[model samples]
Target: MRIKTVQAWWVQIPIEESRQHVSDFGRLRTFDAAILRIETEDGVVGWGEGKNAAGSAGQYAALVHLLNHEFGPRLIGRDASQITAIWEDLYNGSRASAAAARGHALPELARRGLTVAAISAIDIALWDIRGKALDQPVWALLGGRSAPRLPAYASGGWADSAGIGAQLQSYVEAGGFRAVKMRVGSMDDRPQVSAQRVRAARKALGPDVELMVDAHGTYTVAEAKRFAALVEDCDLAWFEEPVTADDHRGLAEFRAATMIPIATGESECSRFDFASLISHRAADILQPDPAFCGGITEAMRIAALASSFNLRLAPHLWAGAPCFFAGLHVLAAAPSGYIVEFSLGANPMIHSLSRVPVTVQDGMIAVPDAPGLGLDMDTDVIARYARQ
Candidate 1:
């Protein structure tokens, strides 16, 4: 089928609880997502979501604009099944624009940051359309089902204004999450303070539960090492983005200093960047978010690269329902070491974006059997949160 129309929405749903979540990026009080809907000539519609540039102002608007004006126009008349060719065209188009501007060459990550997110959403939507046309699940399209249910980890435990420990305890008790990840490195300059927060979360979680910490790339090599040293006693599952993702050498240094497995790559957009991370031995676990890493197509490439290196793939998901489903497919296709990250907090977009909210049962999420991400968007929810 041929592409007919592409639509994008810049949505911001208010967090119901309005809790102050302190992280390396600062406080997060709303769920901002860029949702994309692609329509085929045959009347098939598929949905996708771009990662919300949390702290960057106007990033969401830029994503919507890029999708509507640039990417959408290019995809309008193309064969929907030519996903690989379309992805190359998009990547080359972005690179050509950079080359025409000046002799200055923006790094792959920097160049992709400008348009890859828009490309990601469009690519995912196209895949969804393809799956619907073929009447096959995305996971099956990727490769036959690898597991019955993928293990999920609760992704909350943010340093809430009320109490980090209490927030974690409540999520575990209510969600039945076997594993949890908490925010760390909020006090960038103070490793001791960050370590204290990690200790508190471990204490609340006790010894039976698995605990992980995400620094969100807020620390220097020295700071990450110091914090890791302090929290080593807690037996962390992994240290996520302890230092800036860009600092591969620094990340390697941090990894060498701590026995805790290093996890990075949420900001990475392509397989090339992930290859660099593996070559540099920067991380043991690779967390590529489909919304940020050039959609499901590129995520598969990154997953293959990770598997070759025996590195684990745990998709980084913190967006709306579309992203969550996209991540789920990737996790389902990934090897045994993979796990899904489910947001534990209350975000109206996550709970309401689709007619049937994605849920975790007994700390595991079953793969959706329906075609094309197996989700039906709730237009009412989109109308309620669409930017006016």
Candidate 2:
């Protein structure tokens, strides 16, 4: 099962005006991603995705170029089944042989960021190829699924305090979602204002439904603490990325100050960074994005950390088809896995880029039993949106 070809694309799909919502990211005009497609010599094809930014709104041309021009060539004749070895080789760069022999990473200076993202894409595609080769689902290859289906929390809220409640309630009604999350921090100008919005949402949705707030890592330690105090009675399921990813100590500080669960990891890339968070006791919930955090391989490693530390796993699934599917399989296999994050906003990459629909029933998402990532790309959509 040798890899014959590897290709990547920067697919940019514009969000139709009617469905657009503006927030901290400022008018997300287009949804973008670095998508990878790999084919084996025997005609087995696999797909993957890489993320460079949070919220699926960042540039991906460079990421796509890295996969196509640099990482893609190295896999031309390699065995598709040696996924871990290939990941180590890509991660350690020219020191692949020495690093492999050393029993630990001796990575290049460019170990993180786009380099890891490129590796993430390759690793995901390799897993897809392996699953197809064995005629098993990716989760099955990960040692069988934890359950048949998992619950999902609606992940979008951008309206004002008065409108926010209705907005989140609509998300609940749309798919019978029992939990919903909304944006907090800088956009509202003050922590107090963001808290007011949360209160209004709580009043509208009532207590039975769970509520969550994400600052997009846009708040200071003090500001986050204040927000937590203001909404201490509101019963937030978790407070996500209260401080920047660069400040694990501050996040740990925030976590110490509040009873609310702290979930962070979308902006992070690799198991080493997650180990640092675990060391700091910074989070109660781990939120690794399969695309950003070295794909399914490293996500499982992070999940192991979560399970080891008595934390919960909730992958950030706000990107394209491959990334989302990768998260599903990982969550299905993760011992600490919790609910899925279903994007409530209009995402063409999730809806238009894949032939199969990502449906939610009774507020839950079923883990796909189909071979590979259980997705078929809509090539027509790719052709129209691909930039490279």
Task: Estimate, for each residue in 1-388, the C-alpha lDDT of model 2 and write its tens digit.
Answer: 9999999998888888889888888888789888899999999999999988754457787888899888899899999999999999999989989998879999999999999998888888889989999999999999889898999999999899989999999999999999999999898999999999999999999999999999999999999999999999999999999999999999999999999999999888899999999999999889998888999999999999999999999999998899999999999998999989999988888888779888998899989888999888898998898885
Candidate 2: stretches off by over 4 Å: none
Off by over 4 Å in 1: 55-58, 94-110, 160-162
> TM-score of every model?
0.92, 0.99
Task: Return the top candidate by lDDT.
Answer: 2
Report the lDDT of model 1 for residue 51: 74
Candidate 1: global Cα-lDDT?
0.81
Candidate with maximal TM-score: 2
What is the Cα-based TM-score of model 2?
0.99
Give lDDT tens digits, candidate 1, residues 49-162.
Answer: 887475222348878988889788988878988887677667767574564466443344444784788878988888899899999989899887788788889987666424
